[model samples]
Target: MTFAFDNAPVWLDLLGVFFFAVSGSLLAARKHIDIVGSLLLASLVGLGGGVIRDIILNTGPPAAFTTPAYLVPPVLATALVYFLFPYVQRYTSMLTLFDAGGLALFCMTGTIKALASGMNPVASVLLGVTTAVGGGLLRDVTANEVPELFNPKSIYAVPAFVGSAMTSALWVFGLFNVLTAAVVAAVVFAFRVLAWRRSWQAPLAVNGWQRRSSDPKP
Candidate 1:
């Protein structure tokens, strides 16, 4: 219930940064961008969401700017992918898996950070989801595509919302801790992987234009 993160795993945050960087770098590789573009995308995807969350919390500078550790993994990941572009592209499934891992990790950490910063539960939940998906949104937009979070054919944001809500609820009930955070993250990650494998989709309304075109002339 208290927002103390004294026992939070440092590795959790590192994993988040690394996997997100991988996903971003892979996207750049797919686009056939040079190493500079790869590194730029890696930085954005690895830190964009956290930057947004920090700005919202008025945390200033963001951890990526303030912490050398936060900056290293993305840069390393970009170089790794840049050099191994063919192998990475050949195994695209890793991208999806890494992205799912990053999403779950970010949601929990983001929520914890917001709550620790004295944010209200509602704001914390929204920020948690933002932290989970914001980086990918930037990556997609930069790639000139609609964000996966907004796609009706994807379950990306739904799982993030669920994870964030679960963490908040646990915190409210005085049951939150590092273990709970890990469990919640795992659950979110599993849901995402399952949804991807099963092709699960959010419901979408038929466009009025499509309906109008199919109707008889009046």
Candidate 2:
């Protein structure tokens, strides 16, 4: 597969990375972490996904490292969030929205990059999903909590999956080039926002947890 640099989506990718890093830093602050921990978490959330994507694609040092812009955005975001911890706490809802938007954008961008690298459709979709959620997975694990994706009530991974698949499908159909991919990203983002607004969730298991009568009581 041939690799061609596409400048159109780079800015969007950076914006997403910035927001995600900010979100991570805010979480650290909520946990009353020190500046160093905040910066570390922010950087991990910002570049973790891209690192995994690049490794899987066999591309040289993750783009986040090679591009000074990528490095700056996340660092700035981390500092901004750390300094504005009080304000962030007061506006928790807004922070969640920003995080959702970032997830949607990263998923789409990852898929596009994979496709451009000449990966198969399956690999592209998988990479996109990974890029969207890998950082969050790392964050959750670092925080010693269950990953959000495994929570049946959470819509996080679903939105990313939809966005990545939609973008890949559009590419296969040859509609609107990369711009269409952006549209798909927007759609995924909108879905997440709406889901949050409405508290939309996956159906829960019905009567699947009925304790067996023979089981010993705790």
Tens digits of per-residue lDDT, candidate 2, 129-217, equal 99998887887778666676665546678888898898777766666355675677778889888776665666557755654466333
lDDT of each: 0.83, 0.77
TM-score of each: 0.87, 0.85
| C-alpha positional error of residue 200 in candidate 1 after TM-score superposition, expressed in Å | 0.7
lDDT of 1 by residue, 50-168 (tens): 88888888968887788788888798999888778776676767788888989999998888888878988888899999999999999889977778888655689988999999988
lDDT of 2: 0.77
The regions of model 2 sitting more than 4 angstroms off are 1-5, 177-179, 203-218
The numbered model that scores best in TM-score is: 1
Candidate 1, pairs of clashing residues: none
Query: What is residue 96's positional error in candidate 1, in angstroms?
Result: 1.2
Kindly give the stretch of ten consecutive residues in candidate 2 with the minimal lDDT sum. Answer: 209-218
